[model samples]
Target: MGTPVAKIGLVPCSGEALPAGTVCRLACRRVLDTLMSGQTVAICLPLFIAGGEEERGFAARHPTITVDGCEKRCAAKATELFSGKPVRALLIPDILAQRGIPMPTRLRGFGAEEEAAVQAVAETIAQAVEGVVAQAQAQENQHGAV
Candidate 1:
């Protein structure tokens, strides 16, 4: 039988105080539900931090991408602390700042600006997932060739 494809875990920020946190969650949802779909799995930050064995075990087995809302990097830090280091880490504020997009202010309601941010972040996550998958496939091929 052929080797099974590896899945990438997505860990999004859980902070509700900042609107950027909302963007992180929304963007990750878009990637999980639409953009990357079956290629990715969502890792709940709260559950991971709270010692969810299943969550931690999946993260430990698969590559992970952590999306953080701010500089605190709670998601990234927690994932690293519990399950090795993540394959990729993304910060929404840095992405927005680099792209000249302002942070969304509304926490619950999303406007055009928020939607744009979500799209951008989702695209970024998709790209990261693609890279991780490609690298894994290459490594698998190389090992199979041996």
Candidate 2:
């Protein structure tokens, strides 16, 4: 059989109080469910923090990308603390600011602006996943050649 493919873990912030947090979750969902699909797996921040062995194990074994709502970087910090440093960390607010998109206000009242933010973030995550997978494959190939 062929070697197993590498999967990237996605850790999304669990801050429900902030609209950016909602964007983080939605964007991750898009990446996991559609954008990257089988290439990525979702790691629940709360479960990881609460000592979920499965979540921690996955992060430790695979490359992880953390998506934070704000500068607090709760997801990134937790993943680093429990497992190892994430391969890539993304901040929703920073992405929106860089794109000149305003921060979302209401969590429930999502509109075109929110959709745009989600699309941008999801695309970014998908790109990151591709990078991580490519790097992993390169390393595997190098080692196999030895």
Candidate 3:
């Protein structure tokens, strides 16, 4: 009857171990940016196995877009294991690897360079989610008119 609603989410594979300090916080900011633009987004910080389980449940009920900082695939695996819904995983390491963005040898907090890196990765993930939402809306329009 109306536009198809899309609930988006971003999740990191490892929270505490993230060399980029407050990377999850940065991810939250990216989600906020989407919401500011009149899009809906949910962010779940899975600090432990139990939290991951909860996130998986939330993702199951909604079409969630998960983003991980590395190749650990923790976020995607958790979402799939708990919710049985496969996530559109945005592995930061994979992206950086593709762009030839060098990896930091030492783990540290979010700095200027790391911030920019995360921003790029986060934006890429957001764009993909937007596309999916748009496609779903288009399909709804097509079906409703028929």
TM-score of each: 0.93, 0.92, 0.75
Report each candidate's C-alpha RMSD, comma-separated, in the order given.
2.1, 2.4, 3.4
Each prediction's whole-model lDDT (CA)? 0.88, 0.87, 0.61
User: Could you give the candidate ranking by TM-score, starting with the highest?
Assistant: 1, 2, 3
Residue-level lDDT of model 1, residues 1-146, one tens digit each, is 33445679999995799998899989999999999998999999888768699999999888999999999999999999998799899999888888888888978788775788888888888999999898888888888898
Off by over 4 Å in 2: 1-5
lDDT of candidate 3 at residue 114, scale 0 to 100: 70
Q: What is the total number of backbone clashes in candidate 3?
A: 2
RMSD of 2: 2.4
CA lDDT, candidate 2, residue 142 = 81
Candidate 2 whole-model C-alpha lDDT, 0 to 1: 0.87
Name the top TM-score candidate. Answer: 1
Per-residue lDDT of 1-146 in model 2, one digit per residue for the tens? 22445688999994899988888888899999999998999998888757799999999888899999988899999999999999999888888888888878887677776798889889988998998888878877887888
Clashes of 1: 0
lDDT of 3 by residue, 75-117 (tens): 6777776665544667777766787766544465556777666
Q: What lDDT score goes with residue 32 in model 2?
A: 91
User: Regarding TM-score, does 1 or 2 come out ahead?
Assistant: 1
**Deviation of model 1 at 71, angstroms:** 0.2
